[model samples]
Target: MPALRIEGYVIVSADGRLADADNVMPDELKFEGDKRFFTAALDRADLIVHGRNSQEDQPNAPKRNRMILTRKVGATAPDPDNPKAILWNPSGASFEAACAEAGVRSGTVAIIGGPRVFDMFMDRYDTFWLSQAPRVHLPDGEACFPGVPARSPQEILAAHGLKPGQPQLLDPADGVSVTPWRRVA
Candidate 1:
């Protein structure tokens, strides 16, 4: 079976709440360590999977071969100027199956999110490249990964036969960090 990776950057409260009220990305409010790691993950991904809302949230969302899961058949492509994407309607076996059809059986397929998409595909992911931002407060926005019960990054890695690699400090002045992990199983 091909490995499916879920990669995202999120800001959460010290206790692990995903959002506030305004629905903005927590990037600006991230701890230096978490911010660094998030950038590294983005650098490593070969593909990005996202919902419509996520696409809208990103500043200069990359123009890669993306797999967008959506219900609106007539919805326009988020970035018509970039390469066209393979659309997957919400149905059938799994989005994984759709991805396979789209030729994502190997290499990294990053599931970027808007929460609902993450919940739908969490169990099928082989590894999650998450940036656990240091405790930051968001005045208004949703959680980075909402509805996911509290599971330390360590716990999730252990359950999936993975290990956390050393985390790098991107910029001390900026207070950002980056961590990497690999599946040993």
Candidate 2:
């Protein structure tokens, strides 16, 4: 069995924040460059994992095998149009066993976020494809990866054995930016 690889792709402020006060991501955050990066990453995945909020946010939930971790499993239903999602409660043993059974074989296993879900599996993840945008201040909203006190992206990367791999400064004309990180060792 190949090692399971957990990858995350999120856009953040230059200062390293994920969202604004209303938990709404900035329009500039989702650049075409990032979308291209995400689509390529998804293409190499055998399974995709996401929180309920992420699933709702996705315009076209993928048709590839998906596993959703949620507290309210029974209360919600998977999108009828998306045939690949499998709902699983985010508890202890059940969650682990379900993930194992998902058959995340030789390809990537992506973990799209909702903060809590990312925190739960952060230490276990192998790589983080984060997009750091130019500095932008926000008054409120949820963050990209939660739990740690606000810190510079460099500090966060240092803690996780991650290093910047690719920096695609979105069209200089557009003023957007994104960086990819690979886990070192």
Candidate 1 runs further than 4 Å off:
1-20, 30-40, 56-62, 74-83, 100-103, 148-165, 171-175, 180-184
Where does model 2 exceed 4 Å of error? Answer: 56-60, 73-81, 94-96
What lDDT score belongs to each candidate, Candidate 1 first?
A: 0.57, 0.65
Worst 10 residues of 1 by lDDT: 73-82
Candidate 2 residues 30-119, lDDT tens each?
667666667777767778887766742444445577887766655334545466776667653354556565654556778777677766
> 5-106, model 1: which lDDT tens digit per residue?
665444345434455565555455545455445545655666677776665323435545677877754333244445647666766436656667566676
Candidate 1 lDDT: 0.57
State each candidate's clash count: 16, 4
In candidate 2, list every pair of residues with a backbone clash.
20-140, 20-141, 21-140, 21-141
Reference-based TM-score, model 1: 0.65
